[model samples]
Target: MPCDKSANADPKKEFFIDVITMDIDYPDCILDLIDNSVDAYTRSEIDDPQIRVTFGEDSLEIYDNCGGISEHDLLNTVFRFGGHVAHDSTDTLGIYGVGLKRAIFKIGNAFEFETYDGVNHNIVYENDLSEWKTRDDDEDGKWRFKVRAGAELDQETHGFSELRITKLKDSYKKMVTLDAKIIEEISIKYVLFMNRGLSFWVDNLKIEPLFNFEVLSNEYLQPSVKLLEKDGLKVKIVCTYNPRESLRSEREEGRYGWNVFCNDRLILLSNTTKETGWGELGNIAFHQLYYPFCGYVFINSHDVRKLPVKTTKNGLVTSDNTYKFILNEMWNQATPVLKYLRTSRLMDEETLIKDAEKSANEKVLQDSKLARSNADQKSIFSMNEKASFKAPDMKPKRKELTKIQYSRPTVQVDKVKRKLGAESNKKVGELTFDLFYDEECDDA
Candidate 1:
């Protein structure tokens, strides 16, 4: 009599699936697919990179004219669970091999992935997740995607990888139905790409950048752009004011705060928390008082492993050494702007309005073209490793000023204001004071 010598130690595919897709949101699943397409574009020699996403009530379609998956990669690496094949030339956003499979399983039960690399290569892989989960493995007892060489694709689909997902999970269907929000998310997340000749479309409508990543740069006022380089990584930080926005009131609109990018993809947008050093010692707490603040931090490196971003590419690896250095630099660069914002509030209402108008018209950099035009100007100054333009110094108000206040009947106040031909109560008070000074004080 012998006891069972071994136990069932094999890992279930279901366990991996649950772990990978559990914490990810529906929109994030969509973004993972797009990140794969963008990585393809980055690694290819394609002249024009275009990605289109079409949403249906129960289905999703994403197509990209970036170079498609190679047959070698298709058979070896693309469908693998959790390893990355290094490409020396391309720095891409995909750190984990799970993005594609995770997205497919997160969105729907059925999927079709087809690719044509614009040469002689064409491959297609389609499967139902539920059946694949229950079906026995191949003779080799290995789980794998069954891919085959397919018919030559048409001109539109040539050089493109297309994915179609059906049977959308009930809980995730709302993400596709609310297409407008998704489009905005794409516009924000891919802003740098959009600026650099990448075209993205959703539901046949061309997507454009909804948020302008510009700041005021001129003779009177210029943005602070600081560059920090450490161990082959380059970080460029720009902090300044947006001429069109104000700090007078709180705004829930995701139009302000820090915008952080890694390898040209936006990882954080309008981030206003301690995670980005908002309430740190050197930086002011994120309040409506600092609403006019706009910042951009771009981190670029040839090694994707060095970038301080998680596998989701939606947040930072805050504990990363590079990120720690970046956080300190962000604080140092942001201190002056915060000081200016705080001091600017001391100005009187009229002076503040005039300053706003002047900044908007003469001093503000109107467009990206103007921003570039001023690049060679002497206004931009560099110190050591950081390059910056000086923020404006507000003229300090006189400390001897006094305020006069009194309550009067509404009828009397209006009548006196009319008699004095004044538009405001303060004007009427000023006129009455001057009359008394001339008639009584002078005669005395």
Candidate 2:
């Protein structure tokens, strides 16, 4: 006798939908949609790429000029959970193929997809969550979305595609209304693409890239640049100074420390933790003296799975071997620059003044240094091999300081402190030393 029975192991799609949306914040849902648009533009290699995000009272829309999804991909992969269409993932941010569906479900219960690739012009598809949840599994025991094609073109159909999600959930309603927060998040994540001429708009307001931190460059002060390659991963580390060191506003100070990117998308900004080797590997821990220190690490690979970014692409996979190597090399490249900063900052501290005019003059000097000829700056950035920063020879002549430590009777120290009118035992020692230096130690 043989048994031919199977236990039910199929996942409930309704529960799966809730599980995916549970972990993501509303702002991230919006960013996921923007990521899709940006990725589409990268894949198509479009010259005049543009993305627009619009919000209605109860709906949200995203439109992009990137090439529309091909009919085959849209029907086969786009709607399927965790289904990724094969393509070159280099310089791309989309991986799990769940961003779109997850974002759609997290935001609303109904959506419309209209796309035009010039050939498959005016294709429209619509779906509602309630209907999708009620539908039974098909013959192959899988849920499927019905796609409708050959719709008439609409007024807002200029771009390759436009997606509108309506009936936004109550939880996400206020999040979409925050125009500035959304714009700032987009600016941080896509500053590189914006620099490359891609324009993004939110609520008809164009997003301008936040000015990225740059190091100073001249004959005496050059930033170090190193290129590391291992296991199909390419990491470029640059250690330099923050040009705004003299006038570090709260915002500017926040930009100090390490900035890391993967495939041109920023993942870590101003990280000064031990994860990036701040207090590890015999390096000095982060302090006010290291304010001018800055490091940039950009990791790229053809096979993005080898990259050290988490699946959300918002954080790093610190446990990955590739990331561990990158971190070690970051410390290697940053050591020299940090050493120079320590020396330079100590000198600045010795001559420091609180005059506003002097601070303004320093700012002027910093600006002039930053205004060096573009050709000279290009030469530094053009170097791809191991290079060292040429620190200026500026160590001032000074008497070496020595710590004089000696144990004395507590009563005696207290008597000396009272005689000298000193506030501390250390101060009493300093006063006695000054008296000795003035009366006994003769410079004559």
RMSD of each: 10.6, 8.4
lDDT of 2 at 231: 95
Candidate 2's residue-wise lDDT over 1-444, tens digit each? Answer: 769998999888888888988898877888888888887787777667899999889888999999888877777787888877667654677778888899888889888877777566644444678667767789899777656776666656544888899988888776635667789888888877787789999989999887544455666567889887899888888887654553354646325788888877888777877767676665556765566777788888766677888777778988887788788888888878766654444223223322223455454344343433354454334667777876654434334688898889999997665544356878667657755764577543
Best by TM-score: 2
Residue 90 in candidate 2, Cα distance off native in Å: 3.7
| Candidate 2: regions farther than 4 A off | 122-124, 150-159, 253-255, 346-381, 397-444
| Candidate 1: 10-residue stretch with minimal lDDT | 376-385
- Worst 10-residue lDDT window, candidate 2: 347-356
Quality of model 1 by C-alpha lDDT: 0.72
RMSD of 1: 10.6
- Between which residue pairs do clashes occur in model 2? none
TM-score for each of the candidates:
0.76, 0.80
